[model samples]
Target: MKKIGILTINDYNNYGNRLQNYAAQEVLKSLGYHVETVINNTDFNKKNNKSTISNNKIQKIKKITPQKILKKVALLLRNNYFYNKRLETFRNQRIKVFKEFTSSYIIETDISITESNIPNEIVDRYDYFVTGSDQVWNPNYRKGSPIDFLTFAPKNKRIAFAPSFGVSEIPKEYHQNYKKWLTEMHGLSVREEAGAKIIKNLTGRNATVLIDPTLMLTKEKWLSISKLPLNKPKGKYLLTYFLGDISRERKKYIKEIAENNDLQIVNLLQIKEKFAYMAGPDELIDYISTASILCTDSFHGAVFSILLETPFIIYDRENQSSTHSMNSRIDTLLSTFRLESRLAKNIKNNKEIFEVDFSHVQAILDEERRKTYGYLKAVLNI
Candidate 1:
């Protein structure tokens, strides 16, 4: 059988990242290829990402008053970055759950590839290396990480499958490097329309805009790997998952919705909710698929909700102006599915927001899956 290596984000903390990684691996395996997710971590990526982060922090500090900055810092330390950051207890169990899902579901290469050790022989181990199904191309997040582009592999052996830029425009700092690496890839496809535009502008090559790999699999397939949480409530509930900070007003909106609908509110990402917060890729499919309604600011959160045919509202995540924002991918997703009305900023007395029509979604999903499969088949020559 032909062999393929998958390269994606190292963040197992993220539901989207791991889900996409698994989806990419599963799709490749179904195509009759031996697939393993390459574990790549590097100090080079870390240093660059840190530099960018510190620079952004510095810029942020420069704009705010000393009192304001101190208040923000104290707030972050106290509430742990408003629920995005967690105490050691949350991280410990959450990471364990993440790894459990990964070990059980994703087939990974035995070797951990890093900057210091590139493993020259490994290039021959896999027929092709594919960077996929996530925002691996975002310079703010990736720091123009060469590994994400599979630069160690021969250009003909490198393929980018539905990787996203995550922003409308590339920062000027990463332009040259992005252009060079993107141009080198043999087969290119992106997850969002904005990503395709960026690819065209950088490489003067039009890339196919493919659906996220998570959507490639049917509901029954996802359910095959899904598990119910042991402590799940016996009652109907409204599910909320937010990767960004959830403001007081937003929480009020969620509470009001749950109260109005006579449903329990379950915040999957809330660190304080120890029982439900330890959810992994496996349990989340059950949580999302069975929810009465879902509210989220995450792209993947919206992705699964749509796939499960659950009523959901996509809130615009915080920190939109930052270069690191990945909201463009979410925008492209809603537009593609004709669900633009679901995005909202204010939820005061909006009864119409709860009603979603999934009647037209399956047809779009069918066409998208066909196109994605066609692209993968031709690109990989399977």
Candidate 2:
């Protein structure tokens, strides 16, 4: 089998990022390739060193004098300037590991590409490379530059699967840079249609829109590998993700709706819930499957709600935008799947009861994945 390298954000604790990374790895295995992951560990020191920032220190900073705050800002600017100078070179170095996954398997590099110290032996090895799943292309990731992937220079081929620019719109300077990257890529698929349009506007290329990494696998497949709830709650409850800003209003609205329905809220973060902490992919899928109704702000949260065929409302709670600009990508998905009525009905009156049918969106996701897989296979010459 051919060897392939997959690059994505892989934090062991963050379920969403982990699921996407695992899904990318599984997809490559399905295509009959021997896959290995190249991770960057820029945040390793922070993740490993728990003492870097303390709650006490944060509280103290919060209460510090204005002069101290100004001094802190000055220090931050100096630190950032020095950090950027070491980023690219630091990322080019790497380390190799032979992990046991049923059998012996190898994973090369750390989690943060910008600060990775990959060994020379693993630097230029691999038939092709993939960068993506969760906002790998987000400009914020590489300090407003696309140099992270470019610096690797993977030989043979390169692809970006279900990658996201992670924003509704692209800025002008980055827009030009994106076009350059697209021209070099052998294959590309974006998770959101808004991103696809942004690419087209910037590059005039008909980039394929695809499903989130979570939808690439079935609920059954996820359950097989997922961590089970510590204990299943005996009572019925609603599941929802907490978002900022409008969340308070949306939460109030949804709670009222649930109360009227006589169902309890199974606040995932609260005690007595099955998946209490940072949940994994399978745990999330199982929770969605069991939820009576889901209210959420996250795209994957919405995706799982549909995947489970559970009724849900797409509560727009992101303070980042007003009703007009708020998660238009989400609006697009809801409208495309005939959930516009539900959105309108929910917003028209949060008290108004409604149900959503996700069969159409699920089908669309499947079709998109089929096309995405086809493109991937073509790039890998499978």
Candidate 3:
């Protein structure tokens, strides 16, 4: 059996991240390979919590006010102390659980939490290294350079499976950096076609556009292990993926659109009972399964909507510069599936947002799933 090391984002509660990890694991296991997700021993809840609200823009806005100054100081001091205590508790509880989870699983591959944990010897040990499930190549994740992960593993045969460079346009400076690293890859597949174009432009290689890893697994497989709620209301509802706080005007428009439809408006970003950013894979699946329609700003939100045969309206971010071409990846998917009407060109002031029809696009996704299976078969040589 070929030993494979799967590298991906699984620390966060992002549904796309978990689904992608599960998809790759499922596909590899079905192909009869010995596989394990390389987990890092890195501490997520260190002295500074990565997901803390203080690091966010809201805290930055409160920095300049006199009253907010005292509040900020108090918040910082409290946050520091609270953060330290949470770090210890989190380390004791979560990290211990992670270690136990890793050990319990039949993991042949060594898991490294941080890029630093990936040793030179471990790289040489694995036959193939699969890097990516979501926006792993995004500069934000890679500390300003998406290809920084490549610098860590020199000996292993590397491949990027359904990797996204995040948004559309990469700067000319990063383009040169991408050219050097991407040339070394064995196989390149991107989640979006526009991302393929970007990669092709840089490497002169036609990247195989694959479905998001989550699509590789059927709903049955997901349902078996996923945490789904019982007794969903038997009515039509819209799945709203507004993690980034939509304006009141947009919220009003959505309500107007759902006036008669019994819309099940699910704000994935809304603070849950636990005060986390959003629900995990199980919670998201339940939300997606019941939603008759979806209005989303998240890439994965749109993805799940399509997979579940739900009609969707995507609110892609506005690109102000020619250099900012991130939405093309999403645009390619929307256009290919003939769901251009469902894509909101203007996130905030979309006058025609209510005009999306889901029937034709639902059929298109069915056809795409067949193609997705074929791609998987080819990749796995099944």
Judged by lDDT, which candidate is best?
Answer: 1
lDDT of 3 by residue, 1-382 (tens): 7777787665544556666676777776776777777765444345233664444546675656876787776777787787678656544543343344334432534335464455657766666677776776765345333333454565336667778877676666567778877777765778887678878888898888877767666667656655553444457666677545577777887887677565655555554322212344665676776676677777777767666666567875542344454566677677766776676544333335444455675466567667755665565455
Task: Please report the candidate that would top TM-score against the real structure.
Answer: 1
Higher-ranked by lDDT: 1 or 2: 1
lDDT per residue (tens digit) for residues 243-264 in model 2: 4444465667777877877787
TM-score of 2: 0.74
Sort the candidates on TM-score, descending order.
Answer: 1, 2, 3
Comparing candidate 1 with candidate 2, which one achieves the higher TM-score? 1
Given candidate 1, what's the lDDT at residue 170?
Answer: 91
Off by over 4 Å in 3: 40-110, 144-156, 230-237, 272-278, 318-326, 345-382
TM-score of each: 0.89, 0.74, 0.74
Alpha-carbon error at 240 in model 3, in Å?
A: 2.1
- Model 3 lDDT at residue 53: 48
The pairs that clash in candidate 1 are none
RMSD from true fold, candidate 3: 5.5
Q: What's the number of clashes in each of the models? A: 0, 14, 12
What is the RMSD of candidate 2?
Answer: 8.2
Query: Tens-digit lDDT track for model 1 on 1-382?
Result: 8999998886778889999999998888889999999988775555653442355666765788876988876764466454444466688888998998999988888788875689867998999999987888886677788899999999999998899888888999889989999999999999988889888888899999999999998989998999998688799999999988899998997898888888998888877788888888889999999998889999998999899988888888876675566788998999999988788753335576667889999999999988988998898886
